[model samples]
Every structure is written in C-alpha cells, then in structure tokens.
Target: MTGPSKKTERETFAAYCCDEATIDLLKAAAPSRGWSENMVFSGGIAGAVRALGAMPCPEFLIVDLSDSEDPRADVQALAEVCEEGTVVLTIGALNDVGLYRDLLHAGVHDYLVKPLAVDVIKAAMHSAEEAMNAVEEVEEEGPASEGKTIFFIGVRGGMGTSTLAANTAWLSANGGESTALLDLDFHFSSSAIQFDLEPGRGLLDALDNPNRVDGLFLDRAVVKPSEKLSILCTEAAIGVVPRPAEGALEHLVDTMANTYRNVVVDMPRHMVPEQPEVLNTATDIVLITDLSLSSARDCIRLKAYLKTCAPAASVHVVLNKLGAVPAEVEEKDFANSIETEINARVPFDAKAMLLAVQQGTVIADHTKSGKVTAGMKAVNSLFTSGSENADGQKPSWVNKLLQRKAS
Candidate 1:
C-alpha cells in the first residue's frame, strides 16, 4: 500500500487583516507540505480586529498597513484583537528600524514589508510552526532538523528579481531550510540590501581559493540571517570585478548542493561566459518576467540563448506582476511569444512585496493564505521531483551499453 501524502498533517493559518490580492497570493503557496489555508478579507485594520476577535486566531495572522500611516497605532490596535497563541505578522509600507523594533516590543511575532511572495510568507509561517513543533517534540523526543536549498532568478530585469530572490531565500533559510541565497548578479545586484546584509568577504573569496572551498570557508563568507538561512549577497561597493572561473563556480555549487538541499542562487541576466555552468548545476532555475512586449521579447531571446548554451538544464518561467484585471497581453500569447511555458503568474501584489523587502521577511511568514503559497510551490515543485528517472522510463543508452559490456 502507498503511504499517506505529506500534506495531510500540515496545519492551517488565519489572516486577520489582509487585502484580497495578497490573500490570493498567500493561498497559492500553501500546498507544498499539504497546508490548507482559510482567509477572511476584512477591509481595514478595524475590520480585521473585529473579525479576528470573533473567531479563534489561527496558527498565523497577516495584517496589512496600507490603510494607515502610523504603524505603531495600527499595531497597538491590532494587539488588542489578537490572542496569546496567535503569531502576529504585520505587512506594510515602512522599513524604519525604529518601527520594526517597536513592533517586536509590541508582541508582533514578525514583520514583513509589502510586495511579498507566497513562499516567503509560507516560510515565515513554517518557522513558527516548526518552533512550536520542536517545543512539543523536545518534551517527547529530542532536537530535530533538516535542510534544503532554493534558487530564485529574474527572467528579465526590473521585474523585482533580486527582491523576490532575497525574500524567498530569507524565508526558507531563516524559516527552516538552513538556506543560503547566493547573489550571482555581478553588477547592479541588490540581494545584500534586501536583507540588510553586507557581503564583506564572500563568493569572491571562495572563487579565489576554489580548492580550499568547504563549509568552514562558506561559513566565513556568508552572512547568517537567522539560524535557518545564510546570505551570500553581492557587495554594495560597485565595480566590474572579475567573475569566477567556470571550475570555481562549479566547485562552489557542488559543495553547497552536497551540504544543504536549499541553496537559492539569484542569477545575473548578462549571459556571461560562465552562465551555463551555473544554470546547468542548479536544482532549479526560476526565470522572472512580466507580461509586457519588451519583457516577452527579452524572454524569447533568453530562451533562444539558453537553448544554445545550456540546453539540458531545467528552466521554469514565472509571469511576474500579473494584474488583477485581465491583462492586454494574455498569458497564452505571452507564453507563445517567449516560446516558453509559464510556470506561475504572481499577481501584482505591490503592497505585499514592498512590505516583505522592507521588513526583510518573506510573504509566507506573514500570511497563511494558500493561494499565494501555491504559486511559489508551483515554482518549487519543478525542483522537488528527485533526480531519479521516472518509473519504467527508458534506460540511458550509456547504461545499456555498460550492461552489454558486462554481459
């Protein structure tokens, strides 16, 4: 008999205050571990408080601050509405340190600045769930943990590629993946700033001494965001530095893949000579694009370019900034024009994304909605299928040849 699906034991989440669009985004990210989410869209802060007060607070709480200028007052008001066990996560516009510190003091479990992704949000939620489960397990058993590596990239620039990559990496690593997000964009890279990280000595160091590369070297190179994730971010000081040699890049990736299952690489779009090496080695590559003519054209160019360079690498295209209203460029037409399939179309969730960047958290941490989480999972699912061949598939000719030789 087959085993039960991983999803069956997953917990549920409740959103006290959330926008319809963000709620949808959160819901999309829910199914990876079989999480089912229920959302209540109360228009504003007061509405959320009333709705939440009426019902038992779910495992997580997501609040939107778009309607208010004073986050302190909003959070204070929200505090009155929440129960002790409900982990409060705020979503908003500001990124001030003072505001974040104040919210933490006010009992906010976490804070996510807006324009968030489903995976980031889910990662946050999972962090809390994991912590709680760990507490329960410690009483019955002992310390338990596992790790994974997740990769994020921009299919095209100005599509919020760095932001999404950083947030997702932060969530998974910080949330529970013990994740490391590598910023591969040589120029104009923003992964460092997104998570308030500064890359002092990093990938460059590892590249310089490829043979010396090891966990100790990486620990020295990467910035630990939370116990869950590390940031191998780009340096803020700008200059066209020498890129790593193909062999060095490969060695670094192989080390990370062997060390952690959840390594996220935010790739540069310039198609450098070594690009294919990075692409081919990754567990998955997320190509971020918007539904615009220029973006579509660029996507097509990229697809054509990749076919020439790394034809065997698995690639998934994500339609970023998909609008609530039917867009002028239909998803089908865009897919056809790009000559690539659309893996996931993230709604234009500006508030959630912005909040996430500012708060230095992923969307999944703040909202429990499965819709947004599902979108991220769709992207993640591309990589989840192990490297083994599917059942009854044809054996490689190389394998057959080896068998005949043995015979």
Candidate 2:
C-alpha cells in the first residue's frame, strides 16, 4: 500500500541527438527494453557534454554525430568526461566501413548510419551491452579470482535481517573492499532508506529483462553513496507483481560477484523462482531469527530447506533481540529447539536502534559501543576469518601475483 503506482524518474539509458527520425525510432524502441521516452534528450553530443558537466553520466549514451565534421574528435572529447564503464553508441550520416572501424577502434561501442531502423538500433544496443559485459567479466575474473557473495535471510518478519546485512556491508566497504548491498525485496524494501539513499529501479529492470543484466546495466542501476559501497534496491508499487525473466537472479548474482570484492544480498522470506538458485550460489548464508517459539519453529524448517537446497553453503544462525528472550527459554534450549547452533546473539538496544533509524544510519554509525554493534561486528568477523586460509593468512603466491600485476 505504501508503494507508488508509477516508475521513478531515474535514467538508466539516455540518447542525445538532433534528428527527429532517430529520436522517433529510439522513443519507440525504448519501452520494449524497459526504458522510458523521457530518458531521451535532444542536444546531440554538445548537449551530453554540457549535461554531464553538472550530473553523473548514465550507463548508456547514444549520441548523434551525423552533424559533426570531426566525429572521432567529438567522441574523444566526450570520452574524457564520461565515467569509466559508460557504453557509448554513435549515430552518423555516413555508412563508410572505414569510419565504423575507426570508431570501434577508438572504443565507441558501436557506430550506426543515419536513418536508423528500430531493429537495427535495438541490435546495436544489445551488442553494446554484451560487449561491455564480456570485457568486465574478463577483467574481474582474470587469473586471480572471483568475488564473495554473502546472503542474508530472516526466519520471520521483524528479525533485523536487513539491519545486520546493511551494517556488515557498510563495515566491509569502509574496510577498503569494494562492496555492494543488493536488496531483492522489490515491492517492500527498506535497505535504501536505511542507508539514506533513494532507491533505484535496477533490480526491477534486471528482473523484467534478464538479458540486460550486464556491467553497463549495473552501472546505471547501482547508487554509490561512497567510493567503495554500491547499493541496488527498488521501492515499487504494491500492485506490481514481479515476474522475473528466467535465469534473471543467476545472471544478476554472477554480474555482482564479478564487479565487487564483497556482495551482500538482503533476501525476502517469500519464495520467488530465483530464490533457490540464489541460495545455491551463495558462498555464505546468515539466517536471523528472534528467541520466540514461532521463530524457532520457522528456523528449523528453513534450516532443513537449506540443507536440501544449498548444502554446500555455510549457514550461520544469528539470534537477534536476545534481551527479549522469555524466562521459559534459555539460549541452549532455544538452540536445541531450532536444531542449529546460535552463531551469534545480538542484544536488543531499542534506543540506539531507534536513533539510528531516525537518523537514516546504521547502528555502528550511531553508537560505537552498543551491544547490537558489537554483535554485528562479531558476525562480520566470522566472514573475514572464513575468507582467509586455515592458518589465517591469504596465499602468498596470490598476493605476490596481484602485486606484480599492479606494478
């Protein structure tokens, strides 16, 4: 009921051109790819240059170069201010093969002749997305390695799963690792609000069009509140039912793993088609629950489910709101009832948590010495420890190789 009926005005894709014909084609084709007509602007390369001077560049930029006498030079100038991973597509009046080859060599995603057909434009856009994704995949995976994915799911509602996930993710990012916090609850997600960020449509776009889940698409969707931390979340209308394209979750997870050193997913308890695959792909899973009997019963059922669905993943059970435990149940008894050991117990600090929520910050940021912060740190330490070798050191060879590559 709290969700908005219309999509937010965040630009995922943009086109800057003067030609009515090309703009018309793009306007017609945008919706098919989950883009809006408002995303298109009319100023050509000059307009893009002026706009980017004041704001962050979009993930994909389509510019008209048919009017320019020096197309390559104009592109070079545009590239100077563009973000590192932005995919650029150019539309020119000429159809010369030499010109196309020159543009491609200069890192233009693709060059199209004027009087563009809708299908041709769509095909070029797809090619650009795929090409950029392929390059990023190679860069992230290389000979060294892939990233780590940690998933957090609650046993029931109001268990503080999102809180823990957000704090841990912030800590990891602040510790110098490139981290991404992804909230998969499309309709009702508070991850963005928790971090004082405005939610974007990245997750919903990926779900609606799985094939578009690539490095360029992520660049458009992810909101970076800091240099190291990226957040992907959405607050959609309650009337909207998400029907993710097949393999959407898997593709999104794979892309995230390649892009960041640490990936945190705050998953909803309600099952979706991609839930099982996401759980299976996680390197670690944290299950948060309270001390109540209903929570224990749900935890037991979820643990059993994980055993069958994600046997290889390490599951950590966190008991939240520990101070609220009834007199009838002790920690040991609660653990026994749930059939899983309590990896961490977070004491309830109602005042501190409330202050944090009101300030739009995490517990660690609000109070450095609170029980909740301490418990979250302990849980995070487990992940840090698990990342190391048995002797608590990363392999020397891997470090040396990375050093040499950096040099």
Strongest candidate by TM-score: 2
The lDDT leader among the candidates is: 2
Candidate 2: residue pairs that collide = none
Across 268-360, the per-residue lDDT of candidate 2 in tens digits comes to: 888622468667768788988887778778888888888888887889998777776453467789888877788987888889888998888
Q: Which ten residues in a row have the lowest lDDT in candidate 1?
A: 1-10
lDDT of 2 at 84: 57
Candidate 2's displacement at residue 332, Å, is: 0.4
In candidate 2, clashing pairs total: 0
TM-score of each: 0.54, 0.61
Give the worst 10-residue stretch by lDDT in candidate 2. Answer: 1-10
